[model samples]
Target: MKRVVVGLSGGVDSSVAAYLLQEQGYEVIGLFMKNWHDDSVTISNECPWLEDSNDALLVAEKLGIPFQTVDLSEQYKERIVDYMFNEYEKGRTPNPDVLCNREIKFDVFMKIALSLGADYVATGHYCRKGILEKDGEEVYQLLAGVDGNKDQSYFLCQLSQEQLAKSLFPIGELTKPQVREIAARMELVTAEKKDSQGLCFIGKVRLPEFLQQQLQPKEGLIFEVDADSPVYHQEQPTFASQEEELAYLSKNIAYTPELGKVVGKHQGAHYFTIGQRKGLNVGGTKEPLFIIATDVTSNTIYTGQGNNHPGLFKKALFIQQPEVHWIREDLKLKAGEKMEVMARIRYRQPLQKATLFQFEDGMYVLFEEPQSAITEGQFVSWHIGEELVGSGVIS
Candidate 1:
């Protein structure tokens, strides 16, 4: 019998995933990942780690599968938590869920499952895995889940072919409603549990409060730039190469006091990100203000009056050579080559029409339509049809 280890995340999707694997005749084991134990930093009140673990145990028992809990708090901190703090300190937003799956679940947890003689590791991600044959070689394809509304292919965008080889997503073919119906029919403890929110392991947290734990509050100036400012009409530099053109195009506009009027003050410039609308607390505007730029060095925030602000959109973004990742390495683009692909900067955003330009320094993704808030430290996943081909950190 093929043995499979399912990561029972104390949620309905994972609960049903374990049951399906058992019905399919696999020797299944339910392992609950206890990734965070530090309550001092965790801000959520109800449904804490203890509750999640107990629910996982109940589901495993009902499914008649071996159940155990693994303490990955140490590794989680080092890989996800610490990495997040460092990114925020650098004024860049990081996606911890993506990193957690790549650095922890598939890497660390998979090792433990392999040590236990398991043939494959499984999760409840709403994405499908496909196999294709090319030149007598097996290539794995990460396809979007059939349920378009909940397709989570972006979170698994960084997964490599080898990782996908030994992985199974039993619930990929089902919709959120269908997964819940199955769990309800099975009377699982997590049958009607709401999806966990906020950080990957840590529960829902007030982001500003969470950051304040590590980042001290410092007063900074907030300057609101006009939509038709002279800065927006500045002359562009001629680029000799694609890399130079992309690098110049992808960077944020340089704003000075001459370009905008001082509007208000912020607690910290590092706490705010590009395109953020809320938490500004600044009023008396025709339209709501949105963050267009943040200068951590100057401790300044540059804002624009409305959603249609010129500063809110960009035509291109660059990913450095070191940050580029191709799940299908066999289909990677070489220098001076280009490909037309659909890409999205954030999870759940509809993929946009874009062209990928490869260069010696990095890859450039130029969207046919301007992309809003192309923030750094976020992964941009490109797709050919429904398959995710590559992803990279937006730089």
Candidate 2:
């Protein structure tokens, strides 16, 4: 029998994953990873690790599998928590889920499982993995799950080929409702439990509040662009000659000065992100105000009211570190090559059409239709049809 280690998060999805694997005649062992908890003294609704471990133990008992809890709290803090703080400090919007999967799930957890003599490690992630033959060599391909609403390929994009080869996702082919049905059939304790939300271990705490606990409040100003001040460039020009003039004006128009008007006084520029509207007190605007830019050096926040024009959204975005999982070794794609692809800017957003342009400095510029809220420090996942190609951190 093939020995498999299942990452049980004390949730219905993972519980069902272990159940299905055991039914397939695999020798399964349940492993719950204990990440971290906020120790700086604040009320948190985070999942108590003890409670989750107990729940996982109950599920393991029902499945007749050996269970063990690995305390990865230190690793989680170093890789995930510290990385999050550093990103926010740099005024970049970092995705903790990506780091969690790359550093913790695959790196730390996988190594631990392999050391225990398990042939493969499994998770409840809604992603499919399959081997493909390329140039007489077998390579792993990560595919989007069948459940469109619950597909988690975005978070799993940072996974390398080797990780995918030894990883198993038993629930990838099943929809959310189908998984729930199986959980109900098995009478798993977490069948009716609500899905986990917010940060990995922090549960349901609002991001801003959580940040306040870790970071010091530094006062900064928020700037709102004044309509009467000046029309730097108008999308529709009055005359043919003015069209050329408008183009030049648009190119030179500075967004930094405008952002300084709306953010009257903020704690810190790192505390906010582009496209955020809530908590911004740039009152007296008829339409809702959205954060268009942040000048960290000048300590300014820029706000734009009314609908964001298509031109304001850029078709191209640069990524700092691109991690690609190619099936073939010799498929060297050159820079400026326009390849048809799909991408997602945020976790919950739907995938959209894009073209990848490789840069000289190992970076990639994704050209797409003006995507809204293309904020720096966030992740952009790439896909070729239904298969995840690669992902990178927006620079």
Top candidate by lDDT: 1
Count clashing residue pairs in model 1.
Answer: 0
Report the C-alpha lDDT of model 2 over 1-395, residue by residue, as the tens digit. 99999999998889999999999999999999988666343235455666678889999998899999998989998988788888887777888888898899988999999999999999999989878887798878889899998899888878877888889999999999999999889888878877887677555656777777677778887777754444434574455643233233223135656323543678788888888888886677788777766766666777677557332365566654344434323343665444677888887688888766554444444455567777777878777778887777777
Report the number of the highest-TM-score candidate: 1
Candidate 1 clashing pairs? none
What candidate 1 gets wrong by more than 4 Å, as runs, is none
Q: Which ten residues in a row have the lowest lDDT in candidate 2?
A: 243-252
TM-score of 2: 0.88
Give the Cα error of residue 66 in candidate 1, in Å.
0.7
Report the Cα lDDT for candidate 1.
0.91
Residue 265 of candidate 2: its Cα lDDT?
Answer: 74
User: lDDT values of the candidates?
Assistant: 0.91, 0.76
